[model samples]
Target: MDELLRLDGNAAAGVLGEVFSFEATTAEYACGGCGRAGTLGGAVVYEVREMGVIVRCPGCDNALIRLAHNRNRHVVDLRGTTSFTTG
Candidate 1:
């Protein structure tokens, strides 16, 4: 993804706040695909539809996180990453 189109993870803090009790953008993620590790603030994020977001690895473009709200329900997927941790 183009650098200019990428929004800082903080920009999604409002939406992420709804799902995580702690601050999510500050969480660390280890990419399973490329062995890249960093805070979510440095990941590549794709805003999907009107109610969803996808977080990808900045190094390998692997889809590491997925979040969606639909039909009054919230869905979160993190299968692509090796680990997602907050400390």
Candidate 2:
């Protein structure tokens, strides 16, 4: 008998795509109060615009004045978790 092992990068990437759908531009800012790098966590959502996606920090709940526009090829639509399998 032989054991079967499976690995799929595409599938993993697809899952990741659904999670992180937004793209960040070259503009990076640190929190003036907390001095924390990178964006905040929690249910952080944004709208895509010509200038950029208007985002807010989940940590401080501060509205980002401006963010450059960038492209994220890994955007995926994950409305439901029906595709996922659980044991």
Candidate 3:
């Protein structure tokens, strides 16, 4: 159960890159909830099955991003993040 819930960000890189136009899994993220910063590759990824993917801050365990796809639309919610930048 736990194994299915936790995976490295690399697992979702392809899907994330498609939405960001860049390699998002290698990007850096600052958590709005804790102000802690970490690379997306270091973050934990939670797969919501066919729904989408959830990325959490490795330092604070706060959700940093949520990505979902519906039909031809890609939905991305970043309320959990204060800032994101690529290295």
Candidate 4:
């Protein structure tokens, strides 16, 4: 990925807020690939207008989350993460 195109997970806060009830960006997460734990705001984010947002683990470059909207609903995929927790 280009350095100019890279953005932190905070960039997805707006979209995440639409899907989650709380402040999703502050949620904790673990990467399935590297087992590194961190807050959502620490991950890498790539926003694609056509495909929505993709959040990746900073430690291992593993894709930890994917968010999108379609059919008047929000779509979230967390299969790439080992665990997710929020308080």
Q: Candidate 3 regions off by >4 Å?
A: 1-4
Q: List the candidate 4 regions with Cα displacement exceeding 4 Å.
A: 1-5
After superposing candidate 1, which stretches have Cα over 4 Å from the reference?
Answer: 1-5
Instruction: State TM-scores per candidate.
Output: 0.85, 0.29, 0.88, 0.88
Candidate 4: tens digits of C-alpha lDDT, residues 5-86? 5688899899888988999889999999999999999899988775578899999999899887788787899999989998
Candidate 2, pairs of clashing residues: none
lDDT (10s digit) by residue, model 1, range 2-85: 322456666667778888998888999899899998988888777765668888887888988888899887799999889889
- Candidate 2 wrong stretches, greater than 4 Å: 1-28, 39-43, 48-52, 65-87
Question: Candidate 2 residues 10-76, lDDT tens each?
Answer: 2223233344444222224454434444522221335343333333444564443323333753333
Q: Per-model C-alpha lDDT, please?
A: 0.81, 0.34, 0.86, 0.87
Q: Give lDDT tens digits, candidate 3, residues 1-87.
A: 643467898888888988888888778888998999888988899987767889998877888999988997889999999999987
Better of 1 and 2 by lDDT: 1
